[model samples]
Structure formats: C-alpha cells, structure tokens
Target: MSKVLYIKANAKPEGESKTFRIADKFMEAYKKHHPQDEIVTLDLYKEDIHFLTVEDVMVHMSNEVEEKENPMKRYALQFKSADKYIFAEPMWNLGIPAILKAYIDYVSIPNITFKYSENGPIGLCQGKKALNITTSGGDYTEGMAAEWDLCDKYLKTIMGLFGIFDYTTIRASNLDVIGMDVEAIVNKAIEEAEELAKTF
Candidate 1:
C-alpha cells in the first residue's frame, strides 16, 4: 500500500486555525481515493526539533569522508519512509515556522536524502510526491501584495532534494484583512484541495 506522511507545522489544533482545517479537508479526500494507503503524521508543533549545531554539522561532514553513521541519521530515515509528503503550515514572516525549518535541516543530509554529482545534485528519495498547504494573513495572489513568498519556495526546494517533484499547493490568504469574504475564500481553497488530493 502507498504511504503518505502528513507533516503538520501549525501550532494550533483543529478549529483554532484555518491551515489545519485545510489540511484536514485534503487528507479526507486523499483517504477517500486511496483507502488502502497508510498515513503517517508528524506534528512538528508538538515535537521538539532542535536546530543543527556546529557539532552536528561537523559530525555529518566527517561521516561523509569516513563513511560512518551520524547522530542525525534517524531524521533521514524518517523522511525516506514515506511514498508521499504533505506540509501543513502557515506563512509566518514570509516563510515557515522555525520548527519546520529545523526539521528540514536535520533530515536534509548528503548521501542520505540527496547526493552531489558533477552535473548537479541528485535526489535519493525518488518516486515521491508532496502537497503544501498554507494560510497567510495577507493576500499573496497577483497585485494584492508583494510576492515575497518564502514558504512555498523553501518547501519546493527541500522536496526537490528528495526527488518529490510532483507537488501541489493550497493557500488561504487575506484572513486578517477586511473587505474580503473569509468563509468564501476558505471554502474555495478547501474545495480545490479536495480535488487535488484525488490525484495525489
């Protein structure tokens, strides 16, 4: 059976946040289409992920030369265990939360999740897909706001390292602003996410 890993980065749970709601809708549709698939969820908000220290980086670097195991190897194993990935986070400071970034740093190890070649970097975690679901207080579509979207770009690049090129994004923006219908926008995003989950 196919395995999907849902990584929830939002600090709030359930009705407390809109990003969680969107993720729920997408997962529901995905499960409906692939009932036999196995689902794994990594709730980063609840997990204590530490930032990579200088010692950690040195250990990884030494492992590359000596071909030895590093302490951060478990993070890479967790990332490779899934056939698909889903990141549920809110756009914070034009990017993702610190915990999600820390998690990526821990997992994105060379020769484990990826490798360097003469031509370019080659991904080790192949045949996987990803879906990114985010919510923002300001509208990021078109001319509504500045296009400084770091969350999407960062997630895409990280997933690319694992060869997860087939991906989709569901966004709900302008929640804190007035003159926009919040319910309508959220419902539309949910509907679109449900449709996208079918093919995922």
Candidate 2:
C-alpha cells in the first residue's frame, strides 16, 4: 500500500478554514478508496520547525556525518519515503504561509531533497505525485491580480525541484469577496477534492 504524507499548514481552526475542510474531505475519501494505505498528517503550525542558521546550512551543505543525525531529519526522511503527498495551505498575502515555507526549507536539504550535479541540481525523490489544495480570499485567475498569485507557482516549482512532477491543484477563490458565492465555490472545491482523492 502506498504511504501518503499530508501536510496541513492552516493555522486556523479546521471548522473555519476552507482549505482544511477540503483536505479533510480528500483524506477521508482517500482512506475509503485505499483502506490499506497509510496516511501521515503533519501539522506545520504545531510542529517545532527551526529556522536554518548559517551554521546549520553549512552542516547540510557538507556531506558530514553530523548532518545524518540532525534533529530535523525526520521531515526530510518523510518527504523522501512518501509515495504521495498532499499539501493544504491557504494563500496568505499572495503566497504560502510562513510556517509552510519554513517546513519546505526544513525539508529541502542538499542531499535529502536535491543535490547539485554536473549540469544542475538533480531531484532524488522522483516518481511521486503531489496534490495541492489552496484557498484565496481574492480570485486571481483572469486579471492583473493573477500576476500577484505566488502560491500555486511557488509550490509547484518546489514540488518539481523535489522530483514530484505529477501533481493536481485545487483552488477556492474569491472567498473574501463581498456578495460572492463563497459557499458554492468552497463546496465545489470540496467535492473536487473528494473526487481527486479517489485516484490520488
């Protein structure tokens, strides 16, 4: 059975977060479809993730044995071993939350997630898929605002850097717009999340 790593980055209560609700639906459907599969939920906001210091960065850059026993090695190991990954985070100020970014930084180690090659950096965790579920207060699909959308593109690029080329993105937009049908938008995304999880 495949192992699924679900990263939850929303700091709000689940009931108040559309992104979390959609992720819950996806995970529930995934369990129903693949009962034998194992699911690991990592809450970034609640996790003790340290900011990488200059020395810490140097330690990872060097192929030293000390890096092998790093206290934060768990995240790197989890990312490397997962068969599939699901990232649920809301768009905050046109980008992913700081906690999520910190988690990414924690896992994107030199040898753990990627390595420099003769030509360029090569991703080691290949052949895995990622599903991104994000919510935005304002819609940016077809306007100058699109230029301000950094969440999807950033996450997608990070996933590719880690060799997770196959991915699906779901967005709940205009959540804060006045008179907008936020319920409809969120519900539709929730439904889609369940459908995608069946085959994810």
Candidate 3:
C-alpha cells in the first residue's frame, strides 16, 4: 500500500471553510477507493510548524549533526517517503497561507527533495503525484483575474521542483461573489472531487 500525505493549510475548520468542504469529501471518497492505502493527515494550524531559523539551516548544513537528531530532516524524510500528496488551502491575498509556506520550507531540502548539479537543481522525488485543492473568494480561472492566481501556480511550480509533474488541481472559485449561488458552486466542486478521488 502506498503512503499518501494529506496536508491541510487552512485556518478555518470543517463545514465553514470552502477548501475543507471539498477536500474532506475528496478524502472520504479516496479512502473508500483505496482501502488498503495509508493516508496521513497533517493539519498545519494544529501543528507547531514555524519559519526556518538559523538553527534549522545549521542542522542541515553541518556534517557533525546526526540525521536522527536533526528535527528539520524528519520533515524532509517524511516528504520524500510519501508516494502521493494532497494539499488543501484557500487562496489568501493571491497566495497561500504563511504557515503552509513554512511547512514547504521544512520539507524542501537539498539532496532530499532536490539536488544541485551541473545542469542546475534536479528534483530527487520523481514518480510522485500531487493533488491540490484550492478555493478563492474571487474567480481565478479565466479572464483578467487569472493573473492574480499565485496560490495554484506557486504550488505547482514548487512541486515540480521536487519532480512531481503529475499534478492536478480542483478549485472552487467565486464563493464570496455577490448574488451568486455559493452552495451550488461548492457542491459542484465537491462532486468533481469525489469522482477524481476514485482514479487518483
């Protein structure tokens, strides 16, 4: 059975957050489809994820530090070990949450997720797949507003650096738009998510 890492980067709880509403349904469907697979959930809000400090940098750079003793290495190892990844978050100010960025910093270590070579940086975690579930108050799918969608683009780019090219995104947009049927939009995305989970 493959190990799947489900990372939650939203501050809002279930039922209230649009991102969670869709992601939770996807997780439920995914579990039914892959009963034997192991799914590990990492809740960023509940976890003690912090910004990378000088000590964190030193731990990885120093040859004297034991791999087991390095706290940051644990995150990198966990990320490298996962066969699949699911990221759930809501777009905030055209980007992802700061805590989520912090989580990425911990997992993205040279020689772990990637390594620099003569051809420049090369990703180590090849053959891994990723699914990103995102929600935005304003529509970021098309038209002029699409340029402002930094959240999805950023995630895809970063994941690519880790050699995960098989990436998919399920987005629920325009939830806060006035006079729109918010429930219908979200429900539709949830339905799509459920279907994707079957083959994901």
Candidate 4:
C-alpha cells in the first residue's frame, strides 16, 4: 500500500472552518476509495513546525558540519517517505499561511529535495503526486485578480521543485461575495473533489 500524506493547514476546526469542511469531504472520499493506503494527516496549525534560521541553513548546506540532531529531519523524513501529498490550505492575502510556509521551509532541504545541475536545479524526489485544496473569499481564478491568485500556483510550483509535477487542484472560489450561493459552490467543489479522489 502506498502512503498518502494529508496536510490540513486551516487553523479553525472542522465545524467552524469552510476550508476544513471541504478538506474533510475530500478526505472522506479518498479514504473510501483507498482503504488499504496509509494516510497520515499532518495538521499544520497544531503541529510545531519550526522556522529555519541562518545557522540552520548553514548547517544543511555545509558538508563538514555534523548537524545530526536537527528538529526538521523528522518532518523532512516523513515528507521524503510519502508517495503522495494532499495540501488543504486556505488562501490568505493572495498567498498561503505562515504556518504552512514554515512547514515547507523545514522540509525543503538542498540535497534531499532538490539539487543543482549543469542545466539547472533538478528535483531529487521522484514519482510523487499532489492535490492542492483551497478556499478564497474573492474570485482570483478568473478576471484581473488571476495574476494575484498565488495560493494554488505557489503550491504547484513549490511541489514541482521537489519533483512533484503531477498535481491537481480543488478550489472553492468567491465564497464571501454578496448574493452568492456558498453552499451550492461548496457542494459542487466537494463533488469534484470526490471524483478526483477516486483516481488520485
């Protein structure tokens, strides 16, 4: 059975957060489809993901430095071991949350995730897939704000850096707009998520 790392980034709990609800619905279907697959849920808000310092960066970069007791290694190890990933995050200020970013920082090691080559930087982590889930109050997927829609795009790009280019997205866009059927929009996204999960 393959391992699926499910990362929940919304700070608010299930009943209180719309993003959490969408993630929950999608995960439920995913579990149903792949019961034998090992699913590890990493709640980023609750987890203590430490931010990297200059010293930390130096330690990772330096081959002579024997930094064996690194706190980030466990997080990095788990990420490296996983065959697939599902990131359920809320779009904040046209980007991702600080907590999720911190987690990414911890796991993104130079030789571990990627390496520099003559052509360019090449990703080391191989044969991995990802699915990014997000909810936004404003519609950034279309119109003039599309340029400002950094959440999903960032997810794809960063994951691609680690050799994960095979990815999909489930976005519940424009939730806070006036006179909009938020429930129907969420339900439609949930349906889409379920369909994707079957193949995912």
Candidate that beats the other on lDDT, 2 or 3, i.e. the better one: 3
Give TM-scores for every candidate, taking all chains together and pairing residue i with residue i: 0.90, 0.94, 0.95, 0.93
Put down candidate 3 lDDT per residue, 1-200, tens digits, no spaces.
88999999988887788899899999999999999999999998998778888998776565442385576787788889999999999999999999899999888888888877999889989999999999998999898888889999999999999999999999988888899899999999999999999999
Top candidate when judged by lDDT against the true structure: 3
Predicted candidate 2 versus true structure: per-residue lDDT over 1-200, tens digit per residue: 99999999988987988899888999999999999999999988778876788876776676643354674566787778898999999999899998889888878877778878898888888999999999998987777998889998899999888888998899999999999998899899999998887888
Q: Tell me each candidate's RMSD, in Å, in order.
A: 2.5, 1.5, 1.5, 1.8
- Provide the lowest-lDDT 10-residue window in model 2: 64-73
Error of 3 at 110 (Å): 0.2
Pairs with backbone N, CA or C atoms under 3 Å apart (clashes), candidate 4: none
Order of quality (lDDT): 3, 2, 4, 1
Which residues of candidate 3, in runs, are more than 4 Å off? 60-66
Q: Which ten residues in a row have the lowest lDDT in candidate 1?
A: 62-71
- Could you tell me which 10 consecutive residues in candidate 4 have the lowest summed lDDT? 59-68
lDDT of 4 by residue, 1-200 (tens): 88999998877887888887888888999899999999999999878776788876775675532244675666776888899999999899889988898888877777677777898888877799998889999888777899998888888898989988898889998899999899999999899998998989
Residue 29 displacement (Å), model 4: 1.0
Assess candidate 4 and give its lDDT.
0.85
- Quick one: best TM-score, which candidate? 3
Poorly placed runs, candidate 2 (over 4 Å): 65-68
Better of 2 and 4 by TM-score: 2
